[model samples]
Target: MLLAVGKAAGPEKTLTERYVERAAKAGRAMGLTGFDVRELPDGDGPTRADREAASILAKRGRGVLVALDERGKALTSEEFAAFLQGFADDARDVTFAIGGADGHPPSLRQAADHVLSLSTLTLPHQLARVMLAEQIYRAVTLCIGHPYHRV
Candidate 1:
């Protein structure tokens, strides 16, 4: 299963919905089978809600945790493909956590098995969601010998 936690803020509400819908569709096309997206209640400061949701989702699967953070390791597409292949080989269920505007709470970062960087530059939280979904679809496609990945 693929689990993501995101804030329900920024952008027009309808635009956000559309991006999420596109992501879900992309996930389906990639044969993810189980894709779960959770919207956490907006918090005044850093929220522990993503971590809490992650823990719950983690219990439902084998728990290969990957968090998207600017400070994490940056991987090329091939590297990402290799990482996913290794996870699949280990028969682990992967959960990719996307945190809120303030970024992931300290506890969540510490709990993550793999902290990944999508880019060095910061991205808007909502845009990150759509980018992550697309990358996931791309990664899965690469793994399955799909021609969708040019590299």
Candidate 2:
């Protein structure tokens, strides 16, 4: 399940929803089931919100926790593919948490099984959500031997 905290603000509402919905479609196309998405209230700061989101995700299931952070490790698409494959093989589920504008709380960073960086540059939280969804979809396709991923 991909859990994103904070409500979509102004320009981000439609785009974020569109990407998430598309991601779900892509997942279905690849026969990947149990794609769950939960959106939490936006906390005042990165630390507070991340902690809250982490708590919510912890209750869901026992799986790898991947936090999307700018300062986290960056990976190539192929590397991401390998990570996803390994994660699927070893865990019952993979939970990805995306924090809001100010970024994730330190507690979340500390608790995450893996901290993934989309890019070093700061991106709006809404766009990041969409990008994360798209990447998840792409990763699923890559893992299932779909032609969607071009080398």
Candidate 3:
């Protein structure tokens, strides 16, 4: 699952949806069910981050929670594939979270099973989703021995 604070407006939404659909289709061969996204309203004010954090946390299920933040451990594509494979091996769900404009609160960041840095630079939440969705598609391809992620 991919959960973000706000909906992607134009091209970002199209790209995200495209990648998610690709991942889901590829994932079926790997015994994966879905690659879905949930969009929440942008939290406002000084408490926005915390409020969004609460909302994201509330939606967290038995899956692994991965928070996307700048201050996170960066992983290579292969390493990320292994990380995901470990969860899939255990038949677990994984939720990749993207926060509001203010980014994730410390609570959500700390509570995440793994904190991932998409890039060293900060990104708009929508673009982050697009990036994440593409990575997910790539990862699924890698997992099933597809050539989509050729080096």
Candidate 4:
């Protein structure tokens, strides 16, 4: 599960849909199930983030929450694949949260099991979704010993 703030618009939305489709196909090919995304309501700043974080956490039933934040730890593709393999081995659900422009609130970051950063630079929300989906697909391929991830 992926919890994101704001809705994708125009071409970003189209690209996001395509990336999602590709990610799902990749996951299926790797025999990994449950690749989904959930868009949350948009609100003002930290307060909105707090509310959305609460909602996202509430829906997580014994699942690990991974919050996306600039301040979070960075991992290589191989590292990420190993991280995901841990969850898969344990049969645990993992939720990746993407906050709005104001970024994730302290409450949300504190609540996350793991805080990960896609990059050091700031990214538009829509583009982040596409990059994340592709990374997920890449990770799945890596886990299955697929040549898609060439070193």
Candidate 5:
């Protein structure tokens, strides 16, 4: 599941839905279940990000936890595919968390099993959500050796 803070609207929402749907269909074909996106309300102030982080951690599962941050380690699409495949092979679940405007706090980063960055550049929360969804689709395709992820 992809946990994102803030409601997605307009083009961002459309693209996100498009990729998520694509991912769901392809994933189902490959026996990957539960491709769902959960949206959370955005908060404010200095504690907003921390509050959101806490909420995410609490809501996440016992499997692999990944926090999205601009400074996190970057991975190639193929590498990401392998990373997720390793967990899938182990029958472990994976959850991805996207923080709000203030970004994830240090505690959240430390608590996450992996801090992943789609790009080093700072992206808006909604756009970041779209990127994540698309990458997830790509990862699934790559794992199944599908054409969606052409080298």
Candidate 6:
């Protein structure tokens, strides 16, 4: 789920929604059960992240937790595919957390089973969501032996 900066407006909202749809379709086609997105209110400090983390954890129950942050480990598409394959092999749920501007709380990081970085360059939270969705779809394709990923 994404902790959006409140509600988005106009084109930004549209683009994000589109990416979500594409991701869900691609994931399902690749044999994932489904994809769901949840939204949390925007906030200023670590407390907010803690709340977001709690909400996610409550919902996740028992599953692998992945936190997205700039400080996390970077992986190639193939490596990401392998990462997803590990969870799939174990039949576990994977919950990915996207924090707000101030970034995630230390508690959130501590709670994460894995912390992954999308890129070295910083991206707006909105764009990060889209990029993450696209990469997830690509990873699924790679897992299913689809040609969507060239390498």
Clashing pairs in 2: 46-105, 47-105
Q: Per-candidate TM vs. native?
A: 0.72, 0.80, 0.98, 0.90, 0.96, 0.84
Clash pairs, candidate 5, are none
**Candidate 5 C-alpha lDDT tens digits along 1-151:** 8889888899999999999999888877667776788887787887999889988988888888999999999999999989888877787888999999999999999999999999999999999989999999999899888998876
Q: Clash number for every model? A: 0, 2, 0, 0, 0, 0
- Report the lDDT tens digits of candidate 4 across residue range 1-151: 7788888789877776776776677777656686887888777744886777777777766789999888999999999999988988888888898887778889989989999999999887778887787788778888888888885
Candidate 6: the clashing residue pairs are none
Considering every candidate listed, which one attains the maximal lDDT?
A: 3
Model 3: residues with Cα > 4 Å off, grouped in runs = none
Task: Predict model 1's lDDT versus the native.
Answer: 0.65
Candidate 1: regions farther than 4 A off: 1-3, 7-32, 46-62
Per-residue lDDT over 36-75 for candidate 6, one digit per residue giving the tens place of the 0 to 100 score: 5666677555477677667666665477888888889999
Error of 1 at 100 (Å): 0.6
Give the per-residue lDDT digits (tens) of candidate 1, residues 1-151. 3344444555534454554455445545544444555555434534465555455345535568787889889998878878877866775668777765667766677777888999999987677776776676667667777787894
Tens digit per residue, CA lDDT, model 2, 46-108: 367656665556654677788899999999877887887786666457888887666777777
Q: Once superposed on the true structure, which residue ranges of model 4 sit more than 4 Å away at CA?
A: none
Candidate of highest TM-score: 3
CA lDDT, every model vs. true structure: 0.65, 0.74, 0.91, 0.82, 0.89, 0.75
Residue 44 miss distance in model 4 (angstroms) = 2.4
What C-alpha RMSD separates each model from the true structure?
4.1, 2.8, 0.7, 1.7, 1.0, 2.4
CA shift of 114, model 4, Å: 0.3
Candidate 6 TM-score, true structure as reference: 0.84
Which is superior by lDDT, 1 or 6?
6
